[model samples]
Target: MATLRRYDLDWLRVIAILAVYLHHVGMPFNGDDFHIMNTDSSKLLDDMMVFFEQFRLPLLFLISGTGTIFAFSKRTWIQFTKERAVRLLVPLFFGVLIIVPPQTYFEHINEYASYFEVYKNADFGINHLWFIENLFWISLAVIPLILFLKSSKSNRLLCFFEQITAKKFGVFFGVLPLILILISSKKYFPSDSKDILNLSSTFYYGFFFVMGILFASAEGTWIHLKQFRKLNAVLFIISTIVFYAYYFMPSEWISPYLTINQRWNLWYIVCCLVGWTFVTTLLGYAQIWFNKKSVLVQKLNEAIYPFYILHQTVLIVLAYYIIQFELNIPLKMLLLLVTSFPIIILIYRFLVYPFKITRVLFGMKKRV
Candidate 1:
């Protein structure tokens, strides 16, 4: 179990969920212009949405890395696996079957597979649920890797990580992933669904995650930086600029493949480094500030897991119904978010609340 509580981790969870939500909800307006992703009725608004796009899931992945460290510390491997399975896999199964199928059915009408085929192949918008599915697999996949590292033979690699932590995190954890991301952008790794679904995405993300674990084990790599607040602030601004520049550039100019892979870019890589540092510093500040002030941030912290499991499904279901209402784009998204949030909340209260099995499977424990 966590010896000390961290509300910043909880806050990170909420923010990540919101990012995924807004990315799906607001991305249409962001002028991404990718045929499969475009839905925003406003060209200018879509362009502006690009400014915040880089910050979206990168922040989520950082939070996830933090959570991995937390989870690794708190449970036996079996317990951790069970907990992660419930949190990740169950939602994936339900989301693929009960939730995303209609959208797949609708979108692929020309090549429409049967509902059974779509369910089996997950040939739907369940594609967006990749984060949850991939993370579940990654959590399981890393168990053996962690076991090997815990063995005596991996001591040298472990010591190297420890030695690297002696320098600034911006040098070790921060710049390292960005360096890999930039290299990959130039040579480019495929970012297809199959890649994201298998070990590729996990290994890709695992490097960032291990950095987080090392940072966490060091336990205040960021807290020590408060003395350099002014320098950190300046770097934060520069990193933000780099992140957005890469996000907005046309796919053709950046990619030889001409697909919207959201593959790494120099600006993207630089910004992620700066962005992760800034966010980590802010998290450190939030941790210290909340400690001194005695603030509590647990309501939605408790609500968030279940909210994540059901929210996208609810949104898709709402969109399924709302699209029939003949609403405009803004009205459509509004109806989707509005309709989904409450209905999902109700499901948490009713359908998911009465049974212990349901609670464990969907993360819907009654608030204590």
Candidate 2:
């Protein structure tokens, strides 16, 4: 059978990576302690980043999960595992060793004698490549489940989801498992930590990964998503508002009735809702608008993985210098954005695109 091509997913992947680039560009000014920080920070940018945080990584993971189905459809489990190891691990190792050290060097320049010193230490962890690392492991972890779902045994499981998605509001039920997973385990695991060892964060993202598989497994799910796009949009808006309102709400203003733990769990539940609604809303709308193919989309889809790998290190290096200039936050951000984007693309086009070795190191399929 010929593999199905999802133009909408291709479009979403490109858009998500671009959003990630923009988010990183805003990081220095967003009042967060990133690898580098600006002298002055913006509360507005901070608030915007906070809002985006609820759903950004979740969307990527879900899309990755969906992509996994397509990937696995073309290969046996062993082949799929090897492909993932090559596609994910090789780049992760390259990023940690080659690409990520510059960010660390710039971050703590005074502490290190030279970039080579930082590289020699090899203590720079995965940095932004954490996503790639998590994805590789999650891909391996889900193989058994994916295989089961592919077998005759999972027919009833797929059928159950199909029936639910057939209802007007049934697609929304997908969020319930995620909410429960988060609310119950968040206290122990603290979903905010990016450490792969952090069970809360793993489960939180893993649920989305699993959901992506289910969405791909159940053919009717996309129809429900598109059908309820409007409703999901409204809910996304409402949930975002509620999430922010709760975020900005003073602790002193809270009712004495709600315990601190209860309040925390409530916040987790709200976050799950916002994340689910945001993802479903975008998926639904993308189905309608981005399902058609484009030459640009195809190009972007090919470059996006390398772009993501290169973006943060480049952004951090540029921002380290850009932040020193006597410019306002917006101008600095604009300068960094304008300069780094093309530089990343050029590096990919000239350095990473043509060569088989560079292509493999950066997680692209080695061209013949």
Candidate 3:
């Protein structure tokens, strides 16, 4: 049977999604081309943004993969797929149709065009809900492998992962494939564009998803994580500090030791390292610290999906007018940040959760 509720994983999911929210809120002030823009931008903010960019989504995907193992253990293939579709797809479709348009509309509303005209154009796209769209498709694509791994013949392959991860050095092998795939992806597919409906970043995230399945199937995986928590934490910090050196250090200071391409290759490898270490470390430490259930986590865990779907739209729409207030960047960013959480919470509590039709459409379970 699948194990009892894992609150550590719940904690990880909540933290990762909140990081995503903060990232989106900060993106505008960093001078990036986002749905909204600030009048003045900061290189400091830009550097901070790049730092979080390294592991934020990768960590999220890894956690999803870990959770998938437990989720699959309890359900047959038919039930699993049905639940996945309802939980992931329903929100993506609903958000795309109802929630996403406002963000795009705000983007173009000040650009000499009507909201209807902007909404009519396909160029507006799905906005932040791309993660949901991509994940749903990936879940569908991996069904055959998920089934095969559950069979008898694949016992050896499953045993191999379990044995390797159980060893002191086995974690190295677990992380090696991820490092290689990340390096190869950067070297070959240098395009940094995102088209959510396409398999643009599939090879990248698929590796993590598969790793998650393997990790969860292995007995005592959480035990291994806890055993090596300190080591992973040290490596995570050192790698991150060095990763920042590449940006903060003067180019002339390090150019003699490494060329630009060499520097970037090294940086990309560290990105994978930091991402890997962070996920493992968080898994380890969270299990140690956050395994208990509580009302706060319970409420946040239940609300996380809808919060993610609604947060960006709320922020963007609010920001559309907040930017025009002649406030400083920090104040503007702060106002949007403070206003967003309460509004999203209130909406979910009253507008989305209470209605059965809205709940199902928003990817919540229907009321009894």
* Residues 258-313, model 3: lDDT tens digits: 98778777767777777777777787798789989877887788788889999999
**193 Cα displacement, candidate 1 (Å):** 4.0
Of 1 and 3, the candidate ahead on TM-score is 3
What local distance difference test score does each model get? 0.60, 0.89, 0.79
Query: Relative to the unseen true structure, what is the C-alpha lDDT of residue 168 in candidate 3, on a scale of 0 to 100?
Result: 72
TM-score of each: 0.74, 0.97, 0.92
Q: Taking the candidates one at a time, how many backbone clashes does each contain?
A: 4, 0, 0
lDDT measured at residue 312 in model 3 versus the true structure, 0 to 100: 95
- Tens digits of per-residue lDDT for model 2, 4-66: 788999998888888888999999998888999999999999988888888888999999999
Model 3, residue 158: distance off in Å is: 3.1
Quality of model 2 by C-alpha lDDT: 0.89
Arrange candidates by lDDT, descending. 2, 3, 1
lDDT of 1 by residue, 1-368 (tens): 13456666677667778766766665433455321333436766665565555455556666676677677666778988988877778777766676567656645545654657676765655556677776776667677665655468766765666555445544325566665654564454444333453444455455556555555544445454444454556667777676666666776776886444346445545655655666555555555554432234566666677777676555644554565665577776687677767787799778776677777666554445
Q: Which is the better candidate, 2 or 3, if ranked by lDDT?
A: 2
Poorly placed runs, candidate 1 (over 4 Å) = 28-40, 105-126, 144-173, 185-188, 192-201, 225-230, 244-271, 288-296, 320-332, 364-368
Model 3 worst lDDT window (10 residues): 191-200
TM-score of 1: 0.74
Candidate 3 wrong stretches, greater than 4 Å: 122-124, 196-200, 253-261
